[model samples]
Target: MKDGLKQRLVAQARAEGFDACRLCRPWDVRHVPERLAAFLARGYHGQMGWLEERSQWRGAPEVLWPQARTVIMLGESYTPECDPLAGLEQKTSGNISVYARNRDYHDTVKKRLKRLARWLIDAAGGEVKVFVDTAPVPEKPLGQAAGLGWQGKHTNLVSRELGSWFFLGSVFTTLDIETDPAEVDHCGSCRACLDICPTKAFPAPYQLDARRCISYLTIEHKGPVAEELRPGLGNRIYGCDDCLAVCPWNKFAVAAREVKYHARADLVVPKLADLAGLDDAAFRERFSGSPIKRIGRDRFLRNVLYAIGNSGEGALCHVAQAHCEDADAAVADAARWAVLRLRRDANGLE
Candidate 1:
């Protein structure tokens, strides 16, 4: 009966548009506490202090819900039809991460996880709880234990069939679903992801130092990006995908089938000058339902100014100069820095 129910759940997950579905015992991830501790001890999480606050519960899923006998892990692919790295070559344009280019995945993935959890509970007469990235759960490790994928050297889950261009969600349930065998690390002898990082965020093959991660600096880090590191960020406005894009396993990957996951044409390569003009209200209106809205206007503009500075286009000097007097100190500082960069580019100075 448990095997039959597990099979039904997998089929339903596929029918609902998830790329893959797998099950594992909730206690399967209990062994991850040591690595979790190591990561936290090294302060690799950067300003995401929440990782430290929730470390105890995050490393052990069973602690999160003592009654959960099984965990259903699902993966949703968000691969774009075209290479996401293409915009990086265009210095005047900003490259937004493919994940943030569409409607936020939290809403889309959560709704699906909730619907699936409800269905499982109703069909199997058990209790369940669903979670997306917002939860304290260590999703990547859990995904690994559930056989969805192995934790790649980039520290993101990578599947043999789906590659790394996927989002994960979990459903903890009291149902006794049969477990799938965990996937083995297939990244042996491959350091492509580690070497591809523009900011050199990876300190070791499988370890990431978020402080140096462009994604963290551009999106998560609240203060001024270190002056030395800003150049490596290039024009990436939000999250960095260089590591994911360079993974060889992605060759077999398919573009996202869900229309909601499709990249917005305007977001693909937004003009830095146009983005720098947005105020808080304008930013909210433009990014409504998009992940970029979470960072709010000031931080978003700070990123835009960084891109403008790197653009090396004197034509963008006016935009940078305008933001130099922005009310937000961070934006103003970034704008001032951009003006200097533009000036230096134009007149070959120290």
Candidate 2:
């Protein structure tokens, strides 16, 4: 009976737009707490204070809800239609990560997880609670614990079929579902994801220093980027995809079938000047449904200014100059730094 119910859960998940699903006991990720403790001790999480605050709940899913007997891990692919790294050469334009190029996955994936959860409750008669990345759950480790995928060296889940281009979701339930075999690491000796990081964010083979990650710097970070790391950003105005795009496993990744995951024409490679022109109102309107909107106008411009400083296109100096006195001090600071960098390039300084 448990086996039959678990199979039905997987089928329902796939039918609701999830690419993969697997079951695990709530306490399956035994080693995650230790790894997280070490990571937090090293202060690798940076300003994400909440990760530390919710360490108790994040460290033990069973402790989070003792009554929940099982966890159903789900993965949904949002693989880019074309090469994500190709935007790097288009230096005059901004490069947003492939994940953010489409509609926010949190909402899209959660809706499906909810549908699956509702089905599980109705058919199997169990209480359920769902979580996407919005929670402090150790999803990558849990995903591995449930056989969804292994946590690659980049610390993102990588599967034989989905590579690194997927989002994870979870349904915690009171049902005693049959668990799947845990996935084992298959990264071998390859370090493509680690080496491709422009900021060298990896402290070791599989460890990441979030402070140096471009994705963190451009999004969660609230102020001017550390001056030394700004040039490493290239023209990436949002999250960086270098690590994920360089993974060898991506050869197995097929393009995403969901229409919402398709890139909008303007966002594929937006002109730096055009992006820099966005005022607060325009920024909100332009990014209404985008994950980029969460950072708000000031943080968004701060990232764009960093990209401008890195562009080497002296013509954009005037665009940066216009924002030198921006209301947000961090944005103004970024503008001043960008103008200085572009001016130095104009003067033939190496």
Candidate 1: C-alpha RMSD after superposition: 1.1
Report the lDDT tens digits of candidate 1 across residue range 130-210.
999988887888888888999999999999889989999999988787889998899989999998888889989889999
Q: Against the hidden reference, what TM-scores do the models get?
A: 0.98, 0.98
> Candidate 2: lDDT over CA atoms?
0.91
- Global lDDT of model 1: 0.89
| lDDT for each residue of candidate 2 in 1-350, tens digit (9 for 90 to 100) | 44488778888888998888988998998898899999999999999999999998899998888999999999888899899999999988999999898689888888998899999988888799999999878899999999988999999899988889988999999988889999999999999999899999998988999999999999888777888999999999999999999999998886687788889988998999999999889998999899999999889898888889989999999999999999999999999999999999989996
Which window of ten consecutive residues has the lowest lDDT sum in model 2?
A: 1-10
Q: What's the CA error at residue 80 for candidate 1, in Å?
A: 0.8
* lDDT scores in order: 0.89, 0.91
Best by TM-score: 2
lDDT of 1 at 119: 83
Tell me how many clashing residue pairs each candidate has.
Answer: 0, 0
